[model samples]
Target: MAGLTVAALGVVGFLGYQAAATAPDHPTQARPGSHASQSKEKDKDRGRQKKKSTALPAASGTGERVVYALDDKRVWLVGADGKATRTFEVGPSPASPDPGTYAVTSRNEGGVGSDGVQVEHVVVFHSEGGVVFGFSAAVDGSMPDPNARKRTGAVRESRADGSALWEFAEVGTKVVVIP
Candidate 1:
């Protein structure tokens, strides 16, 4: 009788071990209320806010027409009829020779020995065909020195497709547009 009892206990232990080892890794049943449902609710709230902010009025040409972006980083050519004709990305602003023109300089001083290298100075001629010219200058601000300025010959004619039509070296001061 004692031997039979011992045998029965050993069989029960082996069955428990086998069940644990062969069980699925994940839980068979999910919790009553999971975080997955809560996350979906939060996403819906964010979507509503985004929709409200981008709710622009219909193309009505009768209201006050303006050609500026909300962030002021980009300018749009809006007709008096309240229609946006063209849009251009305008970077930061600085002093310029031409009135209403602006200049923006993008520099990186973090890299090794990058203190002397200036990335690019984009001078945008807003009035004249909305021309945007790019130039690499020194960190000392010697090349595009707004003070002792010379018109770097049209580096290239501004194209609608953002391509350089022509390029001339650092020529004289005045940009002579040859027709």
Candidate 2:
């Protein structure tokens, strides 16, 4: 029943997105100066964009890189040929690095994360104001509570994704954060 509900919602959301994209707004009903309406429209557009788009970010530098998008909570592993080899969603970290390029500075095969979770494939990238940012997978295959009041900077991924990232992004690999 839960799966059915999710499938139904996905179908509904896709249909709504398609209708909005192709529908013509009536000129007589246009509220060109209505800030509220404009904001709502932009929100809807962002939702559609997140659902439908996974194209590598244009400004993310070429060559092999790990591209992390702050707003989307998604990461793309790009190859040297400038193609994304893998993309996946991540559990949001309490801390995020600024939008820029950095390199994978360190890594660990397995260890306990700052959040106190037993994790593996630890890939460290950036640090800011005492917060160390990296990607890892919880050994228990669990995700942290987004509402929790923790201050850890581990951007958690699924076990499979973590292993893939570990193999792809070794030390010195470029990591790009984009807003």
The numbered model that scores best in lDDT is 2
Candidate 2 lDDT tens digits, 19-130: 8766766223437668757876898999899886577878888899999998888899999999999999899767778899999999999999988899999999988877
For candidate 1, write residues 1-179 as lDDT tens digits: 99999999999999988887668663244354667556656879877864553333343223323222223223333444555455443322233223222323222222211123233322222233333333233323333332323333122112331221112112221221111
**Cα miss at 118, model 1 (Å)?**
11
User: lDDT of each prediction vs. the true structure?
Assistant: 0.34, 0.88
Error of 2 at 112 (Å): 0.9
Candidate 2 residue spans exceeding 4 A from truth:
1-47
Error of 2 at 46 (Å): 6.2
All candidates: TM-score: 0.23, 0.72
What would you estimate as the lDDT of candidate 2?
0.88
Clashing pairs in 2: none
In model 1, pairs of residues that clash are 61-81, 151-173
